[model samples]
Target: MKRRHFIAAAIAAASLSGAYPALAETDQVRVGYIADFWGASATAVATEQGLWEKHGLDADTKVFTNGPLQIQALGTNSLDFGYIGPGALWLPASDKARVVAISSVGNSDRILAREGVTSLADLKGKKVAVPEGTSGDMLLGLALEAAGMSRDDLEIVTADPATVVSAFASGQVDGAAIWYPFVDVIRKANPGIVELAKNADFPQNQFPAAFVTNPATVTDRPELVGKFIAVMKEAGDWRHANPAETIKITADFLGVDAAVLEQEATMGTSFTAEDLAAKSKDGTINSWLDGMAAIYVKQGKLEKALPAADYYTADLFVK
Candidate 1:
């Protein structure tokens, strides 16, 4: 049934003019995205190269700082589509939206500790700043659990990632968990800061960035959503083929040096059809989300464990 549906949808999208037509046929799609770093690779590649427009979509890209804000916008029906980390869906608002595609999985996040705080264990009993319910927040949680502690073991202060950096600078917190290029921001401002852990440093913190849509959007316009994923997959393919160019474009978008973005490029894994297929075949993503849901429920942030299938879908990206 899923295969037949995918074939039908793919044929419909391609039959318009040609396979992946470079034509615009719709009004601006208000797309919420992080301008900083989370999903920057694809956004920079896709937007700059007119991938969306090529697929008959005029994406009105709106800059958001984190997954919580983007996911919140989806609940209110403010965004047609957008990117979010797994942590964004940990909140109750997750029920309002569903994941349409998985874009990337990598180590783009890190834990920044004040000079004297050198290890995750040292973060105990200290005020730790985190953007609660975001991927970084989950990373901090997993790291704590790995260390035989919980969020309760530390003074867990909640704020967005940008403000978490500010709070860290103002001496309001002893340690902070954030991802690039904000991690770059802190390292530049205070060379003395040390990384206690990065996403790659922990096995439990494998992060994923996905495109989510309002459930209404998917049901009302599955074809359009399919086009969006097709273009996104194109962008991902292009980034891999033209890594240098995409890196430069991403650097300009984030106002960081190509060198910094270059370093970041090596930090995480980008999703291709093959990667997504392998993970899906092994039920990797769903299993991971099941564990993450359990963690969020244990923390009492969610009312119950939402099914992994409810939060993410690969139907659009299957082809």
Candidate 2:
């Protein structure tokens, strides 16, 4: 071939290569989580390790102190996905919002009581701080019922987990229901003063703290959702292998101590798609939710059974 013809052929080949399809750029997926907890730690790992990008998702993570605000953001379309206690989904779902939980992220929050409180019965008439309407509150209700008491038996105070330590220290509350790290703080400060409720005592152990998304988002962006789950599972694997590093990264993100993150990380287990699928089908997840709803109904926090099974989908974990 002539030189000009050869050059033209090369140019054509280059143009074709440039036009070849590449990975689709995923739409921004905003994920909400309360800081320093397992969910937040997972989000941080996914972001830091580029797992989401590797799975073709551009994840934008947002931190919230409570589920109500996170679910509100989901309803308004400001957030595409979030992590919250499975029971918290009921209030939003009741209001015509749809959320499908993709996986179980954490479990069984501890009820940390101040000094001299030996057991659940010791909490009677004491001030207990919990994030109202959250899994912590639901678990607290269950513990109270198990002890033949009720929220009426104590002074219930609503506060964020971050403030629970100071609240307890200042005598603002005699006890608090909190996830790890914060619970760790209370344990460290008060030593034998804090008592933890074991997972076996309440259905809170299997409670689904999940990766949730609005119905419209799930339907409209199924690929994104799939990718998000894939990345989350990847992050979970990384977290399990690199617990110390994961703790440090999470601590940096939450502006807390690595020791605190380490303590929180130890409090729960992470799941993969396979684990999630088995739990969903075995009715374990549903039963846990049902038990929580029962407590809420008895407490008058929920007027009726809210169809807990509809809020989660095992198919999301199938792929």
Candidate 3:
């Protein structure tokens, strides 16, 4: 009854707010994502452009500050879909959410520091900020490892991405390893900060950003899943064919400067429907997920080794 009320309220609120317009009656869907981040720009694009409605889904997005929170919401059946870094899925080791497709890919990571801080070695005993359960948290550990240090050497503070910039600016944290457009906030304030490491530097993680859905949705409503994929493909097509428009839409949505967005939002190799189908069939994406799950274990985020197959299934992607 509570879930039904929530969905009904979402539908009424979404319709009343004039956020989107759809053709007719359909199933209401709740999508989750981190606020002001363009890693899932396709979802943003599709939501804004009314593509979900065109495909017969009355979609309303729930904003989470990080991926793990959204993943937790999935366990409670609060969200039908989520756009998040693949790491959060591995942390819980629960078979609640399933990755249906790669929505979009963008690399936005840098170990940002002020003028005086030279390297990770210099950050020993110094405070650094990162949002937990996102790429920043994962890469911060990796960056420290590369610098021959660990989180023990530095005061790793968990701050919301929204406040991390203020924390750095006020000397609360010596530095931060966070994703853009938040990185742009740091850069705009302190132009002298440099990247201690980048996403390209960590070749092992694959840095996959994906669209995950409630498992029951896939089993009970196969055609709806196919329609959702159609929306993803349409959004992807629009992104490639309209780069300038995409940047504008994304920047407007994120409330960041288009110039800053252009610098950090590099859409790496994206997945087409056919590519997702083929890769799922060949166990290629699964290989990356399995490796990522192992990484979570090594990072001590998970208690035991959990297979990627348990974390997510490619059945929806393949079918």
Candidate 4:
């Protein structure tokens, strides 16, 4: 099945059932993540392989269209644990949510331009599609600024992640700033697409997708949070050990092409126990969260930049 078909069926099922069927033997935890984002595959992997069951959790998963929506649900206690892109870091910095784990870090966000657009400056006055409050949106701003241009220089058409790919492919927009596997899809379909910039282009910025929960969840259910983190690590390590099988599993679960997933399979950070211990002990992951918070501060979305320790805790992972 294609991703769109799967999304439609999932939505219909969710509407009719109101929730995933829960097992009576395990504790229920509501999990959320941006749809199609490979960084959030840990949850999907856990669910697919019954890692949640192994860890004594019956996780009910929800697919969000973007990071901010997931953050909103987290704020309302609708999502117990979920993934948030760098753009939504302000929510956690402002106490709307709390970061518990660093899922992946790399240059997954890209500004893809159609043929004849050789530079970021070429995008001026051209329609560019991108979803607001996403890592793609943040990367777009950085790319524009690097070219000494502003959003006013181009026509910014707000579109969802899935919509951007279709619009870009049909020539509805001249350019699109989006993340993989959409970027991969667009490039594969349209050979003329030029990568204007990616998160990696700005070496100063670290693009990390974080696993987060509301502050209340952290305070009230510490053990549950710990178990969730443990399962995430288990899933992550499994992906590291089984790259080809991981691609097949993710393709089956997400309904994306296995080929596309294979090309970007290494995008998700797979940390071993030693890697986690070393990074957590040295506060490397916390610094990445703080860096994202700083971007929110500069954008005026946050009143003040909080220390990563203020909005994030590695205690659950380190314990």
Candidate 5:
């Protein structure tokens, strides 16, 4: 499918002229998400099942290559609503956007080592490739700390996800910290590769994926935002009930092998609207954002630590 940065004028013209009778009463929302196995699943499910229209939204979905770029577009008002993983949570913390809901929570990041490196300490003094500002980097930091080591202990090569994969594949780095399906790709290339640690192994790392929007978008279009969250919740319910069908849809949407996704170890946890409402009231969502902010502060990416209330709220989710 062709991805667009802006909604086409023709679409607006058609909606005004009633060319699309089915969409005449619906609110148009420009949705953006990372193009990965899990990132766009809720959007894809809603699209395929006509849930967006049913919920009074005309979703113009856009695919992004990563969380940072997606959040950048969101910050500049190119996207009205979108997904942002832990990697880009710092952007929202800086007041670029607001996280509205928890999209998923699980182990989406991994630290994979070459055959001979069997433990976290084994990677000490070795070369490690990682995307500098990603959930993978968060996992690497946490894992290293758990092992009583730090970035200085390893020759950390900062690279994008694709480059990290390439470096690991060519044996340019002893280990790589990345997310799937790239992790699966590396394992396919070298079956003996070992997993040093994953976000799942750490009880503290919930790896909460977020659904976000510009603060103004939420303030101006409150009901629209509520409908969007409802659609995602409904889609998440369907995915939980129909794992096989969900896998097929996700594979086709991402152009990934169905078999690989089937074997994915860190399939995220889905929540209901009521579940989110309870979590929100209890400050669970805010606490998650606070944790993300702490990671940024530790990395020195953020100064004068911001509270989760500054950048996140459960009002939309509650509504």
Candidate 6:
């Protein structure tokens, strides 16, 4: 069956049985998201634009400090859906949770450092703040490796992305592995800080951001998942059309200045279902998963290697 048709039929069947009611019938469909850059803004736009409600889902968004906690909520089924980095999905998928890539949020990573530090080698003995076990941390490790250094070469600290800005300014950490908007904020406060790396420098540009759900939910509530994807696509289309407006909404939602949000938005790449499907079929996303799996295995985080492609289902995105 065509993907869209199947989703529509599933939604119709569920609605008739009073299984998944409209948002008005319930408080909201809980969604967990990280508070970095476009993460929270995309969710806000989906809610503000009424996409979730239009698809028979409510907009109940919970802010998570990092991916591990977000994945934890999805595993417990506390959240109907959530966004996470590709690397974080492996651990949960091993535990039987089914995650799907609904769409791309954005790509805006940077390795920021204080003045006088022009390169990774200059980071020796310096404290760097990164959310441990996150894709950002993985990216940092890759950047370090490229510099012929390893995590053992520096002091890595784990902290919230928001706090990292203050941490950098207050000398809590010498450098931070963060994304845009926050990078903008950090630079503004410490004008001499330098950004040493970004996604373009990474292999295969291997950052995959996704919206995922539990296997039980996908199996039992396929229609709901499809509708959710449609809603996300709607938000993505809106974001593409109104870049300025989207930035304003995101900045207001995040309580950051509009200019910082604008800078971050400009650097972000928004993808629709079709774009994601193309990447999936072409092994673009598979390569990223494979790379992450290899990293985790080498770090002793995973005992067995995973078939990277098996961690995601692209059928949901194909119509």
Best by TM-score: 4
In model 4, where do residues sit more than 4 Å from their true spots? 1-25
Candidate 6 least-lDDT 10 residues = 1-10
Query: What is candidate 6's lDDT per residue for 123-229, written digit by digit as tens?
Result: 89989998676766767877887888888889988876666767787778898987766676677678888888887786554566777778787788777777777
The true-versus-predicted C-alpha distance at residue 191 of model 3, in Å, is 1.2
TM-score of each: 0.84, 0.81, 0.84, 0.88, 0.86, 0.83
Off by over 4 Å in 6: 1-28, 86-96, 298-300
Clashes of each: 0, 0, 0, 0, 0, 0
RMSD to the hidden true structure, all candidates: 9.6, 13.5, 6.9, 5.7, 7.4, 9.8
| Candidate 2, 76-148: lDDT as tens digits | 8899888776447556335334445444445547788877778878777878988777767777877787788
lDDT of 1 at 207: 64
What lDDT would candidate 1 get against the real structure?
Answer: 0.70
**Please, what are the lDDT tens digits per residue for candidate 3 over residues 11-125?**
2222212322333547688887664435556776787777888878887767677777776787688887777775565653456567777654446777887787778888888
Candidate 1, residues 1-319: lDDT per residue as tens digits? 0111111121222221123555457656877776544366687777788787788888777767677788778778788888887666575233767777777776777778989776788887899888777777877877776678877778888876667767776678888887765676667656789887767766754566778888887788888788787777777777767777888887676555677566657766776656775776577877766766777776566778778777666555674
Error of 5 at 206 (Å): 2.1
- What does the lDDT read for residue 52 in candidate 1? 77
Which portions of model 1 miss their true places by more than 4 Å?
Answer: 1-24, 91-94
Clashing pairs in 1: none
lDDT assessment of candidate 4: 0.75
Q: Give a tens-digit lDDT track for model 4, residues 164-246.
A: 87788777899998887777767756887898888878778777777888888889988788778877777777766676777
Q: Candidate 3: misplaced stretches above 4 Å?
A: 1-25, 92-96, 220-223, 255-257
lDDT of 2: 0.66
Better of 3 and 4 by lDDT: 4
lDDT by residue (tens digit), candidate 5, 2-102: 76311121112212111122323588889987656567777777788788887789888887656777777876878888887787788788887888888
